[model samples]
Target: MEFKPVTHVLFDMDGLILNTEDLYTVAFQNIVSQYGKDYTFELKLKLMGSQAHETAKIVVSHLDLPVTPEEFIAQTSKEFEKIFPDTEVLPGARCLIEHLSKHNVPIGLATSSSRESYELKVNKRHKELFSLFPYKTMGSSDSEVKRGKPYPDIFLVAASRFPDKPKPEQCLVFEDAVNGVKAARAAGMQVVMVPDPRVDESLRTEATLVLKSLEDFKPELFGLPPYDD
Candidate 1:
């Protein structure tokens, strides 16, 4: 397949870089279980890449839980405080980031997590690896991002922050969510999706490229420097 060359890259955090999606499942299950509800994978598919408050609302409404979205967030926040620090970096994520930084390619993080949530997940264990991003657009916290995934705001904002302010077409996005792929495409950027195995094949069609894991990505295909190995 022919791939477009890109000058800059944007990455999604939760499931793409960190293994926090599983952690979030654990946390959400803990909260919903209290209300005698189970957090289903079908529901998780819809929540991926949404902002914290948006996720809370969806969970509350979908499960018919009595709690308000704010209450659900508070409940989940407590659960997250316990497990988020333990988030592991996903395979090939470190190598890819380091390679991009080493090649002097402009890179930024675009996550639906708020700054506080980002700190919780990154500051403890993955600080050094995440610090490689010159800037990160936290969709829940960034004033410029009026909307989260499924909307182009976050990716557009991330690209604008690049020193050269790259055009949307000049940017490539790495994502692990269907909503994120839509967002990147809506922004006119190419996206490489690394989706969970449970996600339907039809959902993968919108992405410019689909791979099982970041380990499968070949940077050379996108005009980025190839690994020395």
Candidate 2:
């Protein structure tokens, strides 16, 4: 929690900044259900923030279903599109992004979500602090970063976005999953995990600061804002 001399704010989209985790759950279940496999809420919680490839393997194993990985991914992805219209930003997420944008910190988004999906969804808000631009970022499919969280590919991509811009230690990452925390940490960045209440306590251990929610987040705690603010 102490490492708040932040020059950059890196974010994870699905669960941390947006309420798309449950949507993913619903979509995934619907997709798997069509194939007669059981995909539950608990399964989605276990699989959030992961790459489609990583998730398909688990889905196949858990449901005891037999299918090619590529087939499962394609089917689930089609289901996600049907559900993205129902997604919404999380509480305090808009204000947090607005506040940071007003401060002009270089911000980047690191997500396993495809660029097309991010553009369709995140661009609708226009509150995103950075794109793959002069500000810097890396969308999925742009890089060969094969592994997802618990593997640092995404966070590494985020930190490297503005390579000549800010140092990794000077960046702050907001995450809601243990795998995301592990990703940020492995990227040599400090992480504050604002986990969904449904995620268990064991996952919170990997975070540098495990707060209740972004509502409880105070820039003052990191000495970024004056006490009155």
- Residue-level lDDT tens digits of model 1 in 1-229: 4689998999999999999999999999999998899999999999999988889899999999999999998988899899999899999999999999999999999999999999999999999999899989999989899887899999999999998989998999999999999999999999999999999999999999999999999998989999987
User: Which residue window of length 10 is worst by lDDT in model 2?
Assistant: 127-136
**What local lDDT does model 2 show for residue 142?**
56
Clashes of 1: 0
Clashing pairs in 2: none
Provide the clashing-pair count of each candidate structure: 0, 0
Report the lDDT tens digits of candidate 2 across residue range 40-133. 7677766766776778888888887778778888786677667675568887677776676666556777777776666655565543433422
Overall local distance difference test of candidate 1:
0.94
Which candidate number has the best TM-score? 1
TM-score of each: 0.98, 0.86
The candidate maximizing lDDT is 1
RMSD of 1: 0.8
